[model samples]
Target chain A: MKSVEPIFNDGFAGQPPAKRALGYIEDQKKNGKHVVGIYCGYAPVELMIALDLTPAVLCAFSNATIETAEATLPANLCPLIKSSYGFIEKDACPFYWAAEAVIAETTCDGKKKMFELIASRKPLHVMDLPQLCDEPEALDNWTTMIKKLKGFLEKTFEVQADDEAIEQAIRENNQKNRLVMEMLDHSALENPVLGWAEMLDIVFYATPGRGKLINDTLEKGVKVLQARVQNGYVHGRKGAPRILITGCPTAGDAAKVFKIIEEAGGVIVALDSCTGMKPFSEMIAENTGDPLRAIAQRYLKIPCACMTPNTRRLFELDRMIAKYRPDAVIDIVLQACHGYHVESFKVGKHIGERHHLPFLKIVTDYSPGDIGQLTTRIEGLIESIER
Target chain B: MSRSAGIDIGSRTIKLIVIDNGEVVVRKKRPSTYNPMGLCDYLLEGVSYDTIVATGYGRHLFKNYRKGEVITELKAFAVGAAHIAPSCGTVLDIGGQDTKAITIDPKGGVERFEMNDKCAAGTGRFLEIMAAALGFRYEEFAQEARLASRAEPINNMCTVFAESEVISLVTQGVPRSEIALGIHKSIVSRAINILKRVSTGRTLMFAGGVALNSCVAGLLREELGVEVIIPDDPQLVGALGCALHGQRS
Candidate 1:
């Protein structure tokens, strides 16, 4: 199949970040620098950078490694968790393989247990995440957790995360985040200027904190999209139902859902999942003096389904809807991801009652068994959305 | 005079319903082929319908096959159930390969629907597998369920796991009729689980080929404790709805 280029923007205009990050990590490994594998959203990348350790989010969303993970893990666990462990078990993910140690947050119960299995093979740091982010005690708990992370790095890796370096790290992260936001903001348009799958490709494949190259790629993408808008290029279908997709992160080549939606004549305008807009959704307080508190505050605003009293996530959804003007919402809950599955009911109520958007809850697994059924449902949903 | 056709290309059978001048003129059923497009082509070979709407598993495989578009089985079933039983607020459709529990709005729209497509546990395929395991055809399996004095409790919902349980039962000298009843009971139990996702309704309509099995449809009544309505030619409900939709569109 011939690959289609993005109509509005060219993301990762040079090499894709996933390939680039892997290559960079390999180069860093040769230079005797420790590569720290960051698993969850709560894992502190800035802190690792401050401690002179190259931090990279673990690469595990591969189809080949799932059977390897399933052999050791339970059959009914979330695909994401299985993919993570599977990537490690089969030595498939070079990012995790190159890591001297891994820092996994207790985001959900499944991942918490999966981390225990991971600890058996690799040096692992457990970051106990607080569910309620707005509560004063929760903030303090998160702040204290960040401090412990710093201390752990200092003790385990024998590196100093000095105040000056920490502030500089925060500056670097916030800068990259700003560029990513600009790239995301360009998604708000009357006509979708990019393919739904291509947009997800740019968002997900752009490695976490790959610095200059990835940042530059997103910058060029934003500029290219701006130019397209200026040139009066209406790239999307004229009256297609603009959709906002939320719920569990769609990892790796598990993009059949997006493809089905697009094929059904719904143009996905914004994605609110982990791999989409949320990772760079909130901006860190750059000049808070204490970079730890700033990083803690930013991570607290992530709006993950794992968060208890996830009203903030609903609020974020409302904000995205208002900004993007989506005609409908498609909430995807992966099978066996209990947290997202339970949260989908609340999301449905919110979308229907408050937002008044046509809601489609797709409870699916990564398996190919349900693709036809899903396509049928999505086609029906698109018809409903169009109506 | 305008005529419309609805073809439901299900996993097991293809049901074609034709409505001419707002009256049901013809209805046909044939085994679905490996080539669904060819099956649709063969079914409508000499037929003339102004509008055509397809539904079910191979519905998408009908793109460009006809003038009118294809609708999902859920939407078609909702329209069909509402048409058959005007007071049908809920629909429980168990097909050959998939099962769905749908709640219908007063305006003949689907309010909410849940499907069990990931696994074949609660589907007609489950019954077929169990019957084959008991060395009986699907018809004999239905007969076995009817003759059984009581259903033996079968808890396993997984098709692979449940087949083993059935094998173990046969080896342990449990009666085949009881085992068949137990398998039917398991499907009802799974259907109930999907139905519970949508709010319970006062009037429930049971459709799809499995609705032909009186033993299983009877269980839905005892379990739901509601007015259960099973229309004649239960499997044509989806195709009827699609034809109705085709006519309107």
Candidate 2:
């Protein structure tokens, strides 16, 4: 395995995650090495990495291409699905074309059906995700899926992935998760020690489960944050209402909501989205003999909105609320994201009634037209929470 | 008398309210032009107050112009509407740029809120733009809406396209009043669709510049199936809420 390359801004500060991730994938493509794109958290990314393929989480959530995607995709589908397919259909995502194969999961009904469309055009693989992860039968089902995925990768690429490689990958992945967790911990400070965007950029951009170099950069940032917090310093507009964001996976440029929240006089202290803090919440058992089951275990345990009987998310929310002590909980779902949107009602009812914390639910899409409206609503939420 | 003031610099209008000794002593409104900072400075040229707050789309822009909390239009509406109606459980504020429906707690805090900024339809500016395109003054168009024999169905939800549809109807020699009524119904449908996204409480209070338009207000009340209260000056609700927040501070 080659040493992971350092992403030092690619010669410019904040040169977007897609450019960096896609650039790396493009480089891998040039070298004739395989690249794989994984959608949804249920896809076994570590297994792909173990197979000597560069895994890029496919998320090009720019609002620019939604119009083209809207032609075929349902208008009511979430922006994440529409924009992702739009990236491919519009020839906007360089990484999507660069990848040798794409992986999709039945995390939701939208992505499940959407994959049937994407599969006809690109090299596609589908993983049937079990709705209930905690049940033993579901774990068995996930284990079978992971074993099938390992076989699929081996046959598709005509490459061998021994247990040793996956074990090593598991250790590497666990270390990366630990590093990411340490970085997110800074949000727990009485006053957060880093900027909301600064933390979010790291969480949003870093290649999940394999960003060794990004982890190194984040480790340095965490050290700086610790020293800053020790000195009684935090980031964002001071005295803004502290907020916790928990809902749909806010990935890529879909992070516009967090920016709007900050602009509306709210400081995001913690993010509970799949792309934000969920990946790091649990780690794989490094010493497991069957690394596929270990990977499945860790991946299945993720409290994604797709999971049925998703009580683990509530427990996780309780932990986050106790740690972050946010003044209000902002639940943002991409328009038509039923999993998060439905869970938001349960979460909202729970937190608002049980915790007596203010809960603001925001439903939006990747349209620039909604910016003013979102600002108005979120600004009002901040004010109400403050009072 | 200790006084607090609120300036709501909206996309189309600027509203200011002065609260003295816990009473709304003065209220004012001015068109929001390109130079809102200039317009705001002009509005406060001779005004005197101890503390002041600002709320609206341009709230942050006024933060440096004056030292005050940049309250959101949602909370401002919650405060202002509740102060007027007291029992206002929900607020539907249709402004020039945005339309919002917010549910407020008994303590005068916004509980849950929803907004429609994606389209100009269902807002005051929607009516204003459609009125101008039809070559009638806003007051004339609004007045015509009241005399509609029956609201003709205006199906286009997009404001720009709806205007074209209205123009098409005019070419067919359709009465301006019927088209105007149809246009008003489209916005009402838009508002009801947006309000359905969040909790629409029993006590609905209307604010923002559009609240002055009896056509939209009366129709909205009928559509929502509630007695919608309109404060003395609907546009100044945000400023009043700002002043109300100022008193608390």
Candidate 3:
């Protein structure tokens, strides 16, 4: 294999400019800029932006802090929850330190319960997320929750989230989402301009800031992708099996699956998770006159597995499979995550029966111990696709 | 006239198979100790084949050293099982460190599969440790289990815990054959659970080193009520599958 050249250089060099990004948050905090840390995509970022506060995703993605987190929580809990608590307990994560408050939602049981323990350490606000998203009352309940969050933000930061500010934030966030979508659209091309690793690096680098900063960075990324496409700079295996990754949010150590797939000669073309296209694929409605309700509607339709009768996720999967035309779909279910893990059967059935595509569900955690096994499974999928 | 070779460098044992014109010309198996590559060299010493494919746990290492193409054990087992028994719909391979249950499609492609996680609970290693705990040689372990009328019912599936459990059972003066039957039942139950997930067809082709244990095979047949087809050389199935790929390519 030394003599054989690697088909793709999957070096995930995107570190999210940690020191600088964290320092920026701290400097902003010192200047009376409140930062609200959020864990799930269900939390509305536009609300934070409307309140003149920076909203940062505080979901920990690595296993480094998991051991520490397991001390306070059960070892069998979701690694994401443990990692987050571990960082909070150790005061390690710079994002957690920079945040003045945390705005979390009742998404998964592990996180909802873990947030209670974390509330003692920080001024944490939990929003009751209605699981029956398709029901008529869910929108009203979520809108009320949004209003509640707005009220909390107003009281905590002493800033009024007026209708004008909320609308403006919505518009700005919609524009940022558009830019992100534009950047991700490059992968849909006949000759994909972006490799999965490069796409992740660009997305991760562009994510950690205010709407304008994120939009500007994403705009540059789109331009770079456009330029690459124009120059005919095709990357990875041209005819490689296109893989669509769905399930739990992937970043940090969880991203090893993506790296392994690409390294094993499969080109990852679409990501259906929160950290990927889910956040950007949908836009908040502008000119609707009720900005908060619009935000509620958009975030509630996230198609997360936590929602019961999550048929919308399958609908979204159908749309993604049709759009991306992936040869295979790999669902990365985090260990101990009952939501995605149980829902994997539905996902596999939909992908296989409906789309006639191969689906592989990988139940894993934020550890490097399963790399060999993961490689075998992922490579087996790729081999099946190739044959 | 050209011959193709496949080497399955499994965790416990390495198997090599050479095929020419759809006939297996050579088949070999040896314990893969500290230096598997040296043992692989010994296996390939007198073999003559045009192209080679590697499979199993150490496939990538063998691929790197020998410049042979590599295929995952899932595909290898599916193809090998299909080749051996065309009507076989499912395959269960309990290797040294891992266990895999795969359902083969109508075209002999891998339809769906489930592999054991990073733990060695229901693998060959688990049975080996339990066999040692019962003070039975590897060959006599299955024979002793076959003689037992009923299993002692081991509650633990973890290899380490099960070993201790076996030791305690011995201290309590439980029959060694019954404990041995209990270990077989434990591993068989784990395999059955995995088999239920991906299995759609009634015909199961059991392959791997574990298939040699008639006690386990008989138990699987009784529990699953499916036609259990054990190949002539069960350990060489993965290597045979790899050789099949070499022939196609």
Candidate 4:
């Protein structure tokens, strides 16, 4: 399949940050720099940066390695877990081999168990993530876990992360978050300055890469999009149905749903997945005397489906719908992902009853076989909105 | 006055209906073989209409070939059912490869709809497979099931597994009629679960080729305890709706 070029104004374009990050990792590895592969948004990559170690996102987004992973894993498990394990076992992903170690969190049962199998292959650390963020002891519990991770990283890399170093890392990471949020805000315009593919490219590529290079790349992207908005260079049709996409983490091959929605003439305005707005929507408070506590507070508020009594996610969805004012909402759930699939009822009800917007939940996998069915459903949704 | 035409290129069959001055002037149906486009061409040959609308599984392929408007079967069924039975509160369509249940607003608009995902458990194709497994033709399958003394209670819904279950029961000395009745009951239960999700009123319009099965139709009425309206030619509803849309546009 032909890859989509990211939309830009005034001929501003470059290689996707995801690819550039891989090159950076290889270059840094040659310099004898310590690198840590991280999975899930809950892993504190900020701590890795504070220790002067490179943090690379190790989540798998393609279906190529899933067949290899499925030989040991069950075919009914979530595709994301399978793909991630597949890449590690098959040694297909360069970033996985480049990392000196991997950091995983207890975000979901599937990942927690999969991390056990991974420990035998590589040096790995697993953080026991608290699922109930609303409990009074949740913050303290999570802060301890964050401190433990910091201790592990310091010992593993043979580097001492002083308060000054962590403070500097927190400040720089907060700036990166702000730049990303600014780039995403461009889509909120009546005539969006970014297309769906462009937005996905910007978020997925920028979020995983580390240091001044990725930050500068993101800043340049925001500047280009801002310039486009100023010149009234919109990416999509002016009056197309604006859609807000919410559900599981969508990137790589799973991005087919987003492409289908855009092809059906719907402009995506907000993405509520981990690959999009979820991780960067909030920032770590730089002014805090204890940056670890601040980071703990922010990451716990991610509102992932694995959390019990996940009212915060619904509140965030309400806030996004009000801000973006999308004509409809589409929830993309990967097949066998019970958390997102079961939570879709609450999401649909909230959107329908409170916001009074049309809601569609598309349960799919990482295969191309269901492209035809997806197109029909998305087109039907657009038609309903038109009427 | 010039006429408007609608063609539904379904998985099993292709249906065409032409409307002139707000009246149905032509109606045709043909088996949709491997090449649905060729069969669609055959169905449209010599049928004159000023406007054309295509729907069903092959609607997109038809649009690429004919360059005309297309609508999803979900909307098509709601419009057609409302027009056929003005008081229709919902529509349940069990087509060749998929099934749909749609709730309609009083203004003939689709309020909400649901379609079976990537699975063909309670569709017309499911019934045909089970009928063949029992060594009965499609037309006689419903009659045989209706004449059974009691349903033997088939437990499987997956088409392949259900066929295996039927074979196992046949070898166990269970009567063919009882097994046929069991198959009908299983399919009806599946359709009922889909219908219950979308139906809010007592009146429902049943469409698709599966509606022609007397045992299925009788079971739906018996099970739901509501008014079930089956149009004269149930499979032609989508084509009729497309024709109506062509007339308006």
Question: Which candidate achieves the best TM-score against the true structure?
Answer: 4
lDDT of 3 at A362: 91
User: TM-scores, in order shown?
Assistant: 0.88, 0.80, 0.92, 0.94
- Please provide, for model 3 over A1-387, each residue's C-alpha lDDT reduced to its tens digit, 9 standing for 90 to 100: 122212221232333434444655776688788888888889898888888898767888889999898878999988888988899989888898778799889998899899888888878899999999999999999999999998888988888978899999888888887887787777887777676655555445445556666676666667767777777776687888899999998877888998899889988888888878887789988979899999999999999999999999999988988888899999999999999999999899888889999888998999999988898889988877876
lDDT of 1 at A255: 68
List runs of model 4 lying over 4 Å from the truth.
A1-21, A27-32
Q: For candidate 2, give the DockQ.
A: 0.48
Per-residue C-alpha lDDT of model 2 across residues A1-387, encoded as one tens digit per residue: 012222243543465545555665666668677888888767777788788787777755778878888999989888888888888898877778777788888888888888898897767889899987888898889899888888888888988889999998878777777777787788787777654555555665555425466567667756766676666665666677889999887755667788888776678888887667777778898877888888988888888888887998888899999998999898888888888888888998889777888887878787766776677767767766766
Regions of model 1 farther than 4 Å from truth: A1-17, A20-34, A116-123, A131-141, A151-159, A205-207, A210-216, A356-358, B48-51, B64-68, B105-107, B134-137, B140-150, B170-179
Instruction: Put down candidate 1 lDDT per residue, B66-173, tens digits, no spaces.
Output: 556788898899888887788889988899888888888775687767777566777887887888999997787888788999988888988889999999999999
Q: Is the docking of candidate 1 incorrect, acceptable, medium or high quality?
A: acceptable
Clashes of each: 0, 0, 0, 0
lDDT of each residue in B1-249, candidate 4, tens digit only: 669899988989899999999899999999889999999888889888899999988998999999789988877777778888988898988899888888887655777777776778879999999999999999999999999999999999999999999999999999999999999999899988877766735598989999999999999999998899999999999999898887777
Per prediction, the TM-score for chain B is 0.96, 0.96, 0.97, 0.98
**Rank order by lDDT, top first?**
4, 3, 1, 2
Interface Cα RMSD for candidate 4?
1.3
For model 3, the superposed segments whose C-alpha errors exceed 4 Å read: A1-32, B20-23, B105-108, B164-176, B200-202
Question: In every candidate, what fraction of the native interface contacts is reproduced?
Answer: 0.37, 0.74, 0.52, 0.26
Ranking of models by DockQ: 3, 4, 2, 1
* Ten-residue stretch with the least lDDT total in model 3 chain A: A1-10
